[model samples]
Target: MAKTKKSARATLPPSIGKVLKRLHHPLDVILLCVRWYVAYSLSLRNLEEMMAERGLEVDHSSVHRWVIKLVPLFEKAFRKHKRPVGKSWRMDETYVKVRGQWKYLYRAVDKAGNTVDFLLRAHRDKAAARRYFEKAIDRNGEPETITVDKSGANLAALEALNADRPTPIKVRQSKYLNNVVEQDHRAIKRIIKPMMGFKDFRCARIILAGIEVMHMIRKGQMQDDGIARNPAEKFYSIII
Candidate 1:
């Protein structure tokens, strides 16, 4: 009787039980939609139509709700298992439109082109750059060197951080060295271009994070414990 009772329990991971508790759809179905949305360039309506063809009637609004609710959790989980990046860094900022206004997305990649961290801010000044550096350093530890383009704000931010450190970080300003990171931005920009722009800042931040997480997964950034076979498997592995 004990063996039968144990076997009858749901096989879903306990960590996500509370998150998906009230959802009517099966776990695989919900996660598939979320994964497809972020990993590919599919919109909510596109996912809705795809699911409909599979004989399931899921609305686009519900999928949007799922993304808004679950993506942050997915990001949190991904961070815990993210692999350490190289010490030499390349940092840059890109433009993201939120509410018809341009916001700055600060992103960094290691010397090997692995993503270090990303932050979105409303401004492109020294203060915004400093905050992004602080967040990245807090999560990823100090880098030996950071190469940036001829951005005064980025230079100022690194200078401010160096002031508080015992060993100063080497700062290099070269448009050519930063080309790797600038080229990396295209993968993210390509996915978001179809959406035109984000409706609000909060949504933009969350969705952008989801996209980054997927990008990281594609680059084999997550420490998968040797269990996942591909990017999709690696993505689903993070939640468990």
Candidate 2:
């Protein structure tokens, strides 16, 4: 009998494995589409034209599907690599229209201009503010100080949360102090403005996640190098 040799098998990371099934396009091509979609303000139609110019025939709907399906995977992979945010944070809420109805987008950023987190809500009251604050703290840990405008809802939420802590987090109500996070909103706003508005809330949330992840990547907040030498490779390496 001939001797039998054993062969080693390659494994895919869970994050990428889930998305690899039923994916027909090459990994590089998929990554390029995703990168352009999120990293730039290009619309789906624009991406379709650009891909056509490159000798690749892909529909805008396909690009939209890629963004919807892959963004969560990318965000999960990138979360493991994010740098610890600064101790102080600036928090604010902005309005976004979904299906012609206005919704609140609660966003927070550290003093260094790195995004902490964001949430979409139907209201901008104390309950909504508390929910946003709780989610941000849970994800990024509690900040030493939070700067906000004198929104009563925000102040109330801080007070409610502080009541339970042995050492309360400081809240600074100053319009000037929160300029960093306020200005940080422009990147996301610019992306959304081009699309006019999302058709539904779920779709809005999914797309927003992808957009924010791209913003974080561009800001050099998602890698050990503090800057991705090759973004495509860096993104692809997350799963492979």
Candidate 3:
């Protein structure tokens, strides 16, 4: 019998081998840099200085690359372990500056403050709303009811989605009802404010993903025993 070749992803452990290959630093050090950058409101230069204090002479650019490259790996590994969020969702959009240009950041959180999903778009129209809803539903499943602000664009998007699917999702448009997601944006905004602004959209998206993942961890959204010494260590165990 002929032997079947194993796919690269299956052969490697959790896709880290591909990203970490040729790196001289230890996995723990690399993970530390990533964790600090994501979990704290620190700039790349601040992280570099912190690493230097620990006797690691890594550049800020290296830390930037680690975040941009490794965050998706961590997110992909952690998704299967994420606890299922509530079917009732609160949806909202916030504006963020990227390279002096404003972009709409669409975010959805369940009733319990668990982040469902997020999308970045250049506009806040019906098309953008529809795309955001589609991505959120595709990842977290369709919500039983979605609470949003009194935006006609959001209403149209939900209606369009309901028209195509067998299971219709109820839409509620009340500012008070959607406060959960609105409040959730503050953590991200606080972090972004220190950086002045992102240089480009790609970097903004990557950094935002890292920041959101860190927020999810803090909220206990990722699967972990309460016995770990710390959150960063708990995350390290899952990835490695």
Candidate 4:
């Protein structure tokens, strides 16, 4: 029983497990590959060569496909199981290049740190900002308050979207409130710097969504073990 417990402790994150079951890959093979790559920041070719030593034959590209396809699926299903976000919202944007020109991605986060919505647009003007808020409100209804940076876009966005509300929208501008969303973007920067930028906005959006899902998990705002609390920390009751 002790040996069995130690053996079970060696499995990768459950994301790798569900992904393997869904893709019909051998569990040991998939988990081993994922763990090897994540633990050491190895490339697929490196992972493939390492696995080959263990008598599991596979290609670098196949490993890449498995990680890209399944990790996000697991993360998405993981995020959907969370509690609803709070009634306050924070908003921000980051820049990316699309096709040869620069574009902007507008993002919104609820008070509980869940990414409520995002929009990648060619411009960052009043119209684009208004549309991003419009899209989020269309899905989530209006929050009690909206916090953003002192952007004309955000100002116009609230003016456009809350025109019919009884009190309209209270648009407050603050550097600190917007910091949460800005910091949320650092993970994307970390991941993308390794990839040397995305090929297109469509692909970038998918990659961003996957990264955000992972972020939500780390921030204690999303999960799948019947709660959004961190999956890594287990409390062992200590009795004197």
TM-score of each: 0.93, 0.89, 0.90, 0.67
Which pairs, if any, clash in model 2? none
Candidate of highest lDDT: 1
Q: How high is the lDDT of residue 41 in model 2?
A: 82
**Best model number under TM-score:** 1
User: Compared with the true structure, what per-residue lDDT tens digits does model 1 show for residues 1-240?
Assistant: 112222322544565666677777766678888888887888788899999999999998888777877899899989999999999999999999998989999999998999999999999999999999999999999899999999999999999999999999999999999999999999999888766788989988998999999999999898868563788877877764
TM-score of candidate 3 to 2 decimals: 0.90
TM-score of 1: 0.93
lDDT of 4 by residue, 129-195 (tens): 9888888777667788889998887788788777867877778899887888888767656654444
**lDDT (0 to 1) per candidate:** 0.87, 0.82, 0.83, 0.63
What ranking of all candidate models by TM-score puts the best one first? 1, 3, 2, 4
Clashing residue pairs in candidate 1 are none
Q: Which stretches in model 4 have alpha-carbon errors above 4 Å?
A: 1-60, 98-101, 111-114, 223-240
